[model samples]
Target: MRGVLVFDVDGVLVDVTDSYRETIIRTIEHFTSRRVTRDDIQQIKNLGGYNDDWALCKKVIQDFGCHPKYQEIVDHFQRIFLGENSDGLILRERWVARDGLFEQLAKDWRLAIFTGRTRSETRLTLDRFGAQAVFDPLIGNDDVENLKPAPDGLLKICATFPGVEVVYVGDTVDDAKSAGRAGVGFIGVAPQQDSRRAELVELFRQEGARAVVDNINELEQVLK
Candidate 1:
């Protein structure tokens, strides 16, 4: 009676590309007077890095403590990192919620989000993108101690809407793992050139992913 469609926000929904890393690099530079290269940021993302962005900044602090106003620098970086997004970040023609993505899915499933982003950031992205209206319930990183690759978010979604066919659609291997951990159907949305996606696809299948789509548009056929 309550089927669900859960999504990952960053690449699947937001199309962040390199902005997250770029902003974070800038943030680290602003704080500790050290600027991490794009390659380093990609490494961090690949390594499943977490533990308060400040910790990442701390790593740089050891090298360049030259910044006079470290606290101010940190504050500036925070503002930029978790800072307000531009209109394009929220709603651009190219990234308009996958062009009838939720619309088709919502017809059959109770749509929702299970992203690594904070609820505040999630709301900002969704509302600005005009996507909030499509989903009845939303699950954000703020709701759980752990994120993707952790079952908390998926399990929470399953618990919220019990006795329903659950489908977790996400762009990362972590998404597939989280869905498997939650004992639900995992649909891997493996966007092309998404960095290790082929290996991730194999991992997804090994982890019990039901399907893997190249894009949200492909989800229609894959879900069927």
Candidate 2:
């Protein structure tokens, strides 16, 4: 049986450094009037359990001595990310999939998504890339009771495939923990250009990832 190749959307299949990451920075500044850096965001990501960006943003705002309702943060984040007129930071995202990458991977492994993005967010990118057909059982945040670092999403995919070997490609420490808890193999993505590359690589190694690659384009060789 072909193994399942599961992917985390942000930083794995799509580069969200400018979109989602930027949204977090913008959200924090909007609430706190303090311009935060990606390092601020990465610090929280490194600590894990802040998979929900809204939750992370709220924590950042609180650190700056502002207390906004969770829904307030969520609303502001969506405005910046999705935009009021459909022209938001989300459009700034760059597609990471190279030509024929997913097509080739699909030949040997079934592809699926288990991401922090809502189904609509995932679909927007998939539709832009014309990649809706490439992934099956696209598990989004709303699909599960718990998000990453909880094995819920990975277990859901495994249940779908039924006994197939499974591998998860993800970018953060939470992603590794999610895979580990689900008893699935994991490949960590830490691009060479990322300022936090060294830190992420060490964390993935500490988590016992099967392998760590810079990006999904390199995933083919590791899967071999």
Best by TM-score: 2
Best by lDDT: 2
lDDT of 2 by residue, 68-153 (tens): 89899999999999999999998999989899998899889999999998998899999998888899989999999988899999
lDDT of model number 2:
0.91
- Residues 1-224, candidate 1: write the lDDT tens digits: 34788877766766655545455677677655566775564444444433234445555555565534556655665566554655222233135355776777777778878887788867876776777787657888789988667889888878888788888887666677778889999887766766667766776788788888777777778776
Residue pairs with clashing backbones, model 2: none
Off by over 4 Å in 1: 28-44, 49-77, 82-96
Clashing pairs in 1: none
Worst 10 residues of 1 by lDDT: 87-96
